[model samples]
Target: MVVDSRSRTRASIVESAAKLLREQGADAVTTRAVAQAAGMQAPTIYRFFEDKEALLDAVAEHVFATYVSSKTLAEDSGDPVADLRAGWDAHIDFGLTNAALFGLLIDPARGGGSPAAAAGLAVLQARVRRVAAIGRLRVPERRAVELIHAAGTGAVLTLLATPPQQRDPGLSAAMYDAVLRAILTDAPALPTGDATAAAVAFRAVAPQLTGLSDAERSLLAEWLDRAAGAV
Candidate 1:
């Protein structure tokens, strides 16, 4: 088994590789590049990771860990629709908060024989199973959870992709509002304006959250604040 020191070194290398993969596409990520970024020698890098593929597999696992951490699904509340709205709000907040990491999760390249992807997919599957228990899935297809998940992802991507200077936080909040509309089977309409307003609206609804309290929101907000500054 790898000792603590060796394991730390390997984890550092994998983290550097994953960050690079998100910032620059996979083609630009080489073991040598990772070693240089991690401030280690090529042979030392090879000691932990066999090749770019192995490093990528490790990166996939690391990325999936973040996905697992970011599961914001809300269930078991008296109203499934309310639970779903809370879930949508959480999905938007987390996605906007971790835009790059979110991209890695939805990227199609990580499919097929990828242990990292399989682990992440497993988490998603389990979350969907909970939704199934809540009877939130559409009838005949049982894809309500899938549909809700996709809608949440799509709204967040649209919000995050827009330049903060060009658009405004209102757009992001609106996107999230639309997601709630879809999940609740209601007509789509959302507030619009600036990010400050969006932030205010975001905070205003914290009490209504399912399975999450204000303390949890504050803690999560602090974590996202630190991470958002890193980008």
Candidate 2:
């Protein structure tokens, strides 16, 4: 089919760009180079990608998709904290292995413009939500996510900037533990805790409660959020 053919062509172009990025860094992924690598004319690259920036975004996403497809997690870890640790470790490993892709993702100029960067953040957010569900999260889910993301990204960039022999191997785990100490309570707050802790625990699973109507759930979420934030 024409549609299938077009999809393959676009994928081929992205693949070529990704190869260039990995082999020679971000600056090597020029439109002409990608076109030649994919055995297509330069104008054909434009047909698939609006410009060089769009093509670079596609390449970042393509590389990320391939990397994530190779990683897996247990269906239910029974300990969401452990699951969070695993996710953090995997993220660091991904960054260290894919230095060029990681640099593209964390560049301040790109901000959140890259689809792959958003996807990576979404994965982290989900992992944080899982931690919240178990009532172990001390901070609100959003704050926890941001803290962990920033720390992990910082840790990876720090390591990448260091020469391999000089890199501090313990830095990533140390950073994760530091953030965990700030975010997770000793135990689930649902059973015995102050109102704020209880609110945090309840807010984590409030969406799944069948008895609450949509409006009721919305109101409850607002109130719980307030309760969670109250000192």
lDDT by candidate, in order shown: 0.58, 0.82
- Candidate 1: what lDDT? 0.58
Could you tell me how far off, in angstroms, the CA of residue 129 lies in candidate 2 after the best superposition?
Answer: 2.0
TM-scores vs. true structure, each candidate:
0.54, 0.88
lDDT of 1 by residue, 95-140 (tens): 6765655665676785556554455445445544443333333221
Highest TM-score, which number?
A: 2
Residue 229 alpha-carbon offset, candidate 1, angstroms: 46
* Residue pairs in collision within model 1: 169-195
Candidate 2 residues 129-181, lDDT tens each?
Answer: 87787678778888899899889899999999999999999999999989989
Q: After superposition, how far is residue 106 of candidate 2 from its true place, in Å?
A: 2.3
Top model number, lDDT: 2
